[model samples]
Target: MRTHNQRDAPGLRDSPSEVNGKGTSGPEPNKRRGIRGKIINALSPISVGKAKIKHKKKNEEREESKPITVDQIRELIHEKKLFEAGQHLLMMEKASYAEQSKEGKGAARSEIEAAYGLLKQEALRVIKTSVRMAPVNPELLQNTVRAIAEQVKEDKTAALEKANVLSVRPRLWKEAWKEMIQESVTERMQVPPFDGVEGLSATAHSFLHMGKAMKDDLITVVQHIKPHYPNDFRVCCVYAECYYQCFSSQLEGIAQFELGSGDNALLLTWVQNIYPNEIKKHRVLEKELEEANLGTLLPLKQIKHLEETYLINELESLKRCLARCLQMEVTRWTQGREPEKLDGHFHSELSIDAIQAVYGGQKRAKDITPDLGKQIAPLLLVELLTFLQSYKKELERFLKDNKQRQHFEATVIANINNCLSFRTHTEENTMPGQNAVKHQISVVLHEIQNAGFEVLLQGLFQELQALFKKFTQKTWLSCSSIMNEIIGCASNHMATLRTLKEPFRQAIVEKIHLHLVREHIARLVKKKVSLRSAEQQGQLSQVIQTNAATLHAFCTENGSNARWLEPVLPRLAEIIRLQHTDAIMVEVGGLASQYPDISKKHLAAILYFKGNLSTSETRGILSVLDIHLSATLPPTSLFSDIKLS
Candidate 1:
């Protein structure tokens, strides 16, 4: 019987010799030769002729076969036997063509179309079946992708030299990490429970292993990647964290090596620039440092760049100032509990000797000797002040030369006396009371007044005032208590101004008031203006010129009023009302021309004072600024309608 395999060769059983049952019968020689020649012609065409003949033959075979059943096609496809399915379609087409040939060409073509339609439909069914049978293997895919990446990396190294690898290093690192993570997941996820992992259940053990493995890989990636991807702040920070956790052992090896003979100071400076937030903590990372683990984690190269190039000398100087922060062990052991308490011994101020001592203490047995006491002393002192502020409640009251001390006291008393006669606080003085509560202001005004203290009371207030002034001039390690003291001293001094001589009293009072105005300007500008700036100095001069009028008014309200203050009133008035008018107008004009980034509350404050509004009304005007005029303003003038006093 003929089978599907028999279809490969036609008429084998029906040959003349086979039908006669003659196994060795010879055909007529010429006839056999003609048949062989015809066969050779057909075979030669099969080797070289148009592909259409094979297609026609296939179509004929399909026409003779039954139409493919959807289920049978699905089984072949699901088993991934697509070639067998195609053969079955061809057989069916052959059967159809052979049966329909007697009909017209149109009928034969229609039969061929039917067979083709069945084939295409069955192909789609097989596709769906195969897709459903495919296994979900993300791990396998991930590993395969990783293998491709590794191959690419090696190829790149071969094609492009290893020395120029930085160009592709970041991408390579990212790929490597991605691959490592995938591999870790696969290993931990696919692996079954084994001996020595008995404590954890299957699910728990899998997760634990995966987590630990991932952590290690992440840390490794970060350690290698952090120095390269600096602009990516997120990655750098993540790497920093991972370095601490995953590759801690590797980091410990790094720590054993000294930062070496490079410029540590410069390196520190760079660390501050790039990793400013890290330095903002004031403590260094344990792994990146040697000695007492106090140095910064920044590399030497970065630090040198900062010290050599960055603008803003103040910030750089500020960093230098911070480095001198007192080490607690030496200070507490040698100088006693406080700097003030160490009166008999040489003070632990920021001198060259002091810095050396602190540095030496950290080294246990090593000596750190620095020369040049004059310069070193001041630097060390500044450092100590910053450091002390970080740790303690108050700074030591350094005793200046007696003459200088007297001068300092005069400056304080004169300013305070001036503010008392000149400036007025419509609100209750809350600043001094607050400082007293904070323990920053040591002696209260009431206590001094009760004791009937005159010179001593003035001295204490002046001392507080001088301290506040000094604090403002430099960068302190901390400002909480220091700020409270300055605010309190100013409040108390303003309350006491009229009690002092008129000349000194009014001048001091006006200077204090001008400083407050300047403070507002500073905040608005988002930049520092030294007290010596021409604009600020000019403002102060005008405030002094205006104080005579303010002082007279205060004296008139408070007592039989000093006539001395009255004479200077016009001069003061002219200074405030006219000379500064142009400058004030300029600021206002600028604000009018361009919307300032400053808070409207501050803008409205300057406006309120400019209008000479009453204190109660000034706050109300500011409230309007905070609520209504802040973010949006109509093009119409804000000040055009409001009248100035």
Candidate 2:
């Protein structure tokens, strides 16, 4: 064993050769140990642990100091800008884009550059902010993203307002809708990659509530604004649209109460008032007004009142107006005549106009009574017509008395007829050997037809033969008498036609006017009854709908005079229908007790059916019989199966 000093092992720093077994100290000992030993010692577990700790600390520091890769920076920037980094990635990673990138090769390389540039700017900003703040808080990032979204929305709204495209209210409505879309877009952007699909789908449901609010506001505005501008066409259109919306909003309101309000009285009156003013007082508006059937809005009681009042007014007006017009016209006519003012030569010639004037007023006065000729005295219209006929006859007699003029006119007519009857042969038909007779009958017939003497021409050939026979019998008497008789017959026929002209024309015109008046009143009554009868009993309502129209028509015509004639037509129709039904019923059974009235139709029907007449034959008999109905029958079958009754 070595001494204590040897045991102490020479101090490494003090001596180089103090130790015997350990060899050298300090640098020489460390060198003699060999690099492998040192290296092995350095790699021992304890040393390795200390070195690993130090190396880890150094690596963390280096990572913190190095610049972030462009991709990571871009990701951060995208998250801050759009608030939807993953969604953006997904959009960029579309299958189409990916395929294009794979297949297009270098062609789409510029798009990639653009994408990188965009990402780079975004990432740079995010990074710069993150650095300034030292660390990025998640809440701050979210708030930043929301603020950006708000700014984008504001920008879009500003742009729309700047455009000044639509009217203010409509534009506002559109902007509201656009804001909703922007919100949805912003929501979708906010969704993370994992939550994106569900978030988008959920956001769509918000639009339903939004849509309802929009419609409600629009309707409220229209309703509020409409009444202020009643005559404005635009306002009217809007009001109508809004009303339609309200109507559609509630189905029950549309169906029950609204529709049953029946005619739109106010609208009808407005149209009636305004249309005439706009169309320049056209006479055709009268017909249009009638067709529009504004009276359809009136109740039955109102219609009856209108009919009575209007009938009185129209008759009163016509009477006064006609009398005044006739007096004026006659005065004008009388002005043309002058008197010689000599004793006997001052004979007054009765003028038709003077007669018409005197008689017209009388006719109106006569109409005020029940009896036509006796009680009412003669109507001026009747007297005027009678006077005209008598005057024509007197004129004819005077013409005949003046034989020279009469004979001249007669001779002219006869010579014209004779010349027309004398047919000449054309050169083509006048060959030497051809002896054909020319037919002059057609030429004579044409001349007579042209003269408006068709009745005289009807017995053309026979009359001509008679004339020829008369010419041969007795020269003096035959020529004068036969010729005079022919002329007299023609003159008498012409005189009759002329005298009856005014009466016939007046009768027809009055009849037509009455018919139109009756038809209009009938329609008015039908409309009035229809409105009331909608809620009435079915059978009674149907009767009103069906026969009331026809009955009302007659009531409208002739007023009190028609009261007698009015009931006759319906009674007749009822009698006919019951008669036909009873007749057909006879084949199976007896007539129903419902129809109890006796009439010509009933009797005829009983006779025909008992005799077993065919349907066609029965109809023919009824038509010829001209039977009127007096009552109606029940719904009991006339045939066994009722036969589509």
lDDT of each: 0.37, 0.34
Error of 1 at 23 (Å): 22
Q: Candidate 1 lDDT, tens digit per residue, 264-359?
A: 332322234322333223243323322123334344554344333322332244444444443432233333233321222223333333334433
Q: What is the alpha-carbon lDDT of model 2 when measured against the actual structure?
A: 0.34
State the lDDT of candidate 2 residue by residue for 546-619, as single tens digits.
Answer: 44344344324313122322332233223323334454334212222222332334435233312334566556
- TM-score of model 1 vs. true structure: 0.18
Query: TM per model?
Result: 0.18, 0.16
lDDT score at residue 150, model 2, on the 0-100 scale: 42
Predicted model with the maximum TM-score:
1
